[model samples]
Target: MNRKKSLQIFIQSPDLHQIRHESVTGDQTLADLKRSLFPESNHRSSFYFTLHGKPLPDDTPLSIPQIAPLSTLVLQSRLRGGGGDGGATGAESRDCYLKMYSEKKPDKVDPNEQRLSKWQNCALSNEPLREPCVIDKLGNIFNKEALVEALLGKKLPKEFGYIKGLKDMITIRLSSVPRAEDGAKFQCPISGLELNGKYRFFALRNCGHVLSAKALKEVRSSSCLVCHEDYGEEDKVVINGNEDEVAALRERMEMEKTRVREGKKNKKVKGESLEGSRLSGTKHVMAAVEKASAKVEVNGKVSNGGGAAKRFKAIDVAPAHATKEVYASIFTSSRKSDFKETYSCRSLPLGRN
Candidate 1:
C-alpha cells in the first residue's frame, strides 16, 4: 500500500478553551477525525465537528479546501441529560446516538412553501415534535415555544397574519400523540439537547409551536420562528412547564387584565366629567337668559306707567311660548353681549320712572 499523506489540524472543544494539535490522513472522514481526537472516550457519537461556526459533514474528506493545514475546528458535545451519580445517566448514553450526525443547517426548509406534518421535524428548527405541539388551522405543525417566542416579538423572515392570539390555537397533550415512543429522543432545535424537566419547554397559545424555556428566555421579539406569527403577552403557555414558570405566567396574566380594566374605568370617568361640565354650562346660560328677561319685563312696566304697558307685558311674559322665543333670539344673535349691553343702558334710563 502507498504511504498516506497526513494533514496537521488544530482542534478545540466547544468552549474554545481546550486546544490540541493532531495529524491525520487527507482521506479520513469526520468520524475518523473524532476517534483520533477523543481516543479515550467511548461516547464519540455525542460530539460533532464545526468549521467557522458551521457544522462539517461527516462524509466530507479532510483534503477539502475548507480544511487547510493547521486549520482550527470545534468539537462540540450535545448537552446531555443529568445523572444521579454526578456523571452522564443511562438515558443520556442511550440518547447520545440519537444526536444529529449530519451538518445540515436548521431552518433550511421554507415554512411558507412547505407543509410539514405533525410527526415530521420542525420546518424552522429541525427538531422532533414533542408535547404541546400543535397544528395550526392551516394544518402546519410546530413546537409551542417556537411559536410563542415568534409571537413574543422575535423577528422572522416570513409573515404569519392568520394567527392572532393563544385563544385561537389548540393544545396537544402527550396522550394525543399517535406514536409516543418515536418522540422519546426529541431535542431542542436551538440547543440540540434532549428535552427534559431541567431544560423545560413552552408552547405558543396562538400557533401551538413548542420551544425550550432557555430558548424563549433569549428571545428579544414577539415573532414565532416557524410560522413567523407575532404573539402577545397572553399567548404564551408552558408545555409540561415548571411550577415557578406556571405561577409567574398566571400572575402576569392577572396583572395585564387588571391594567386593561383600570384603563377602561379611567376613560369612563373622564367621559362623565366632560358630560357634567357641559350640563353645568347649559344651566349657566339659561340662568343668564332668565335674569335678562325679568329685567326687560320690569323696564316695560316702569318706563310706560300705564295700563297699556301692563297689558303689553302680560302678552309678552305670561305666555311661556313667547318668553322662550325671546330667549332663543338672544342666544342665537350674532352679538350675544350686545343684548346685555343694550339692556344695561335702558335700565339706567328707567330709574327716572
Candidate 2:
C-alpha cells in the first residue's frame, strides 16, 4: 500500500518554462491528484487541463488512455489562449477550435516518437540500434553490422549509392545516457535536453559533441558548444534531418571525397615497358612465350647454316589433374592432317618425285 503509483506523467507550467513529474495509480481520482499537485491556487480553479492540446475534464480518472504513464499534462491560464482542452460549444467560432482544439502547435514534436527515431532505431536497416553503430556525414546513426550485411547482399537502396564503401562512413562513439524508467537514451550534453524529437540536435564531426541545435544558433560560434573546440560548418552534422538536409549532406560527402578518387586513379601504373616486363609478375605465362620464340629461332639458324639446330623443350602446361603424356597428345604432330608438307623441287632432286 505504501509503494508509489507507477503511472507517471509530466506537468508543464503556464509559461512552458518548467516541467514537473507526477505519478498516479488507478485508485486515485484526477481531481484529488491535481488538487494535491497544485495547492497554492485554491480560487483560480487551476485553469483548465490539457493532454496534447485536447481538453480533459477534472474528473477524468487515472486509468484511461489520456492519463497513460509518461504522457504530458499542460497547465495553461486563460490569458495564454491555449486554454480550452475540452471541445468548445456548438456556437463557438472556428477561432476557438484553431486556438484550443487544434493539436497542431507551430513546432510541436513528440519527444517519445523522436527519441525512438533518433536513438533507439537505425536509418539504413530500419531496425533497432545495436552495438557497433556508425554515423554518417549527416550525423545519422545506424547499426554498423546491418549496413555491412546490406552492402554484402547488394540490398542497399539506389538512393544511398553515395556510400561507395566502408571508406565513406566512419565508426562513431555514442555517449549513452544512463537509462531511467522514463528517460531518454541520448541527449544534448550542453542543454541537458533529451534527444527526443521535440528539439533538434547535432553532432560535431571532429570531436563527437552531440548537443541541441539551439545552442548553435544562440552561440553563433564556429566552435563546439560542449568542447569549445574550433569547428567548421561542414563539421556540424544534423541528426534526424529532413530529406533536403540529407540530400545536401550526401552531396557534400561525395564532393569532398572526389580528390581521394582522383589520387587513386593517378597512382595506377598505365602499362609496363618492354624492359620492365621481364622483371615483374609470375613466370607461368612467361614459359609459354619462351616456347613460341624458340620455334622461330630454330628455323632461322637452319636456313643460315649456322650450326646444329638447337632443340626446344616443350613446357608442361597441363593442369594438376592431367598427366603430361595425355596433355601432350592433344598438340603432338602425330595427329592426322588433310594437307601434306611441300618441299622445294631443287632441294628434292635426289629423291623420287
Q: What's the CA RMSD for each of the models?
A: 21.1, 14.4
Which lDDT tens digits does candidate 2 get at residues 206-269?
Answer: 7766768887787798887767789897787877788898888878877878977877666654
lDDT of each: 0.58, 0.64
TM-score of each candidate? Answer: 0.29, 0.40
Candidate 1: tens digits of C-alpha lDDT, residues 84-139: 67775554443343233323422123222122222344433334565556644333
For model 1, the superposed segments whose C-alpha errors exceed 4 Å read: 1-198, 205-208, 214-222, 231-235, 264-268, 288-353
Q: Which stretches of candidate 2 lie over 4 Å from their true place?
A: 1-115, 219-229, 264-353
User: How many clashing residue pairs, candidate 2?
Assistant: 2
